[model samples]
Target: MKDVYGEAIFDFYKGDHSVVLTTHNTYGEPEEMPVEVFFRDHQDFTELENLAITSCEGKILDVGAGAGAHALFMQAFEMDVTALENSPGCIETLKHSGMEKMVNQDFYAYESKYDTLLFMMNGLGIAGKLASLPFFFSHCKKLLNSGGQIILDSSDISYLYEEGVAKPNHYFGEIQYQYEYKGKKGEWFDWLYVDSKSLVQETKELDLHTEILMTDEYDQYLARVTGF
Candidate 1:
């Protein structure tokens, strides 16, 4: 991830600052610059979508572009890119780099459109925002050019509710279809919270099509906009 704030932190740590505010030490600090709580590393970081099988190039829309990493990545490949970040602070940072074109408006209000809509960083959670999935896809479908696709990231949690894996949950509300696959014991990830059925059913309701671009024992879905 292209973390501008990270660069600042490094500068502070390497320079004359005796005190630093990292995650572990933040609570002990008297003054601290606020950070985006959701900021984290992408274990399943999205690279170039298979160009031969999927033309995820040309005009691209990267929704919820935190810190503009996706935009910078696409720019390196020479694709036309536009980012939609609701946070004013993020937009300001995106402007500083001038890596790609961007929109400060909400994705719902985005009108310029694109040939591909990218929902990297576990956009399933945002799409699964309390029945907004359908509405979100509707807007994406309307925004995409013909043959455009919606590529997003998600994981399968069905294994979590399976018979046995070693550890057990605290029995939190009817099992709730948690993510049980993919991930070494100690690695961390962004919160997408998507499983196979929910991801498929929700997108299908919006008339979009999906495909499992790349996955492992645990599932991570990259859905496409099939113009439903």
Candidate 2:
């Protein structure tokens, strides 16, 4: 609840080049990744992110638009884009970085409809758990206009069990994460990383059509889902 991650992004934006993210996950030891807020441009984007951006059309909503990176990319093309983020500090950074439209609100409670809902950086993890997929789809249905599409990315995460390790009792993709910056630790939160096969099956039950847009060697993939 302290928005430690957002604070780090804001600090990096304010010229603190030493900011880094310390992430603790259920499946692994703590890892440190440098936070390069000011330097995140189109060149730093992955293939999946590029595919999603080029495929976007009409009005767009970039969910969890941290540092406004994806939204900024779309804005460069003069696309109608809104950067939606819940972090106040990140929102400040987004505004300072010249994001024309920024919203400080949760994606689930957002009511506007858009031609494209863009979720990058494993954005679908916001669904939290496999059991929440139905509700996630239902909410997305309400936020999409006619012929709209949801472009998002996530990893299979099955590689964690390749060493003959026992999987968690719940779904494999259901993960817990916490963030640490400096000497402070944030609260733990649930995140999901659904595989492509399971995503297709779940979408079918929701009456939505899913397409595997791209898959990399690392089991991370981008998917497009269209409402009925």
Enumerate clash totals for all models, in the order shown. Answer: 3, 0
Instruction: Report the error of model 2 at residue 76, Å.
Output: 1.4
The sequence of per-residue lDDT tens digits that candidate 2 reaches over residues 43-150 is 978887789899888999999999988898789889999999999989999999999998899888889989999888889999999999999988988888988999
Which regions of candidate 1 deviate over 4 angstroms?
Answer: 1-55, 158-192
Best by lDDT: 2
After superposing candidate 2, which stretches have Cα over 4 Å from the reference?
A: 37-39
- Per-residue lDDT value at 70 in model 1: 62
Instruction: Report the C-alpha lDDT of model 1 over 62-136, residue by residue, as the tens digit.
Output: 887766656766676677888787656567666765645888876767687678777765565555442555766
What pairs collide in candidate 1?
Answer: 150-225, 157-179, 157-180
Which is the leading candidate under TM-score? 2
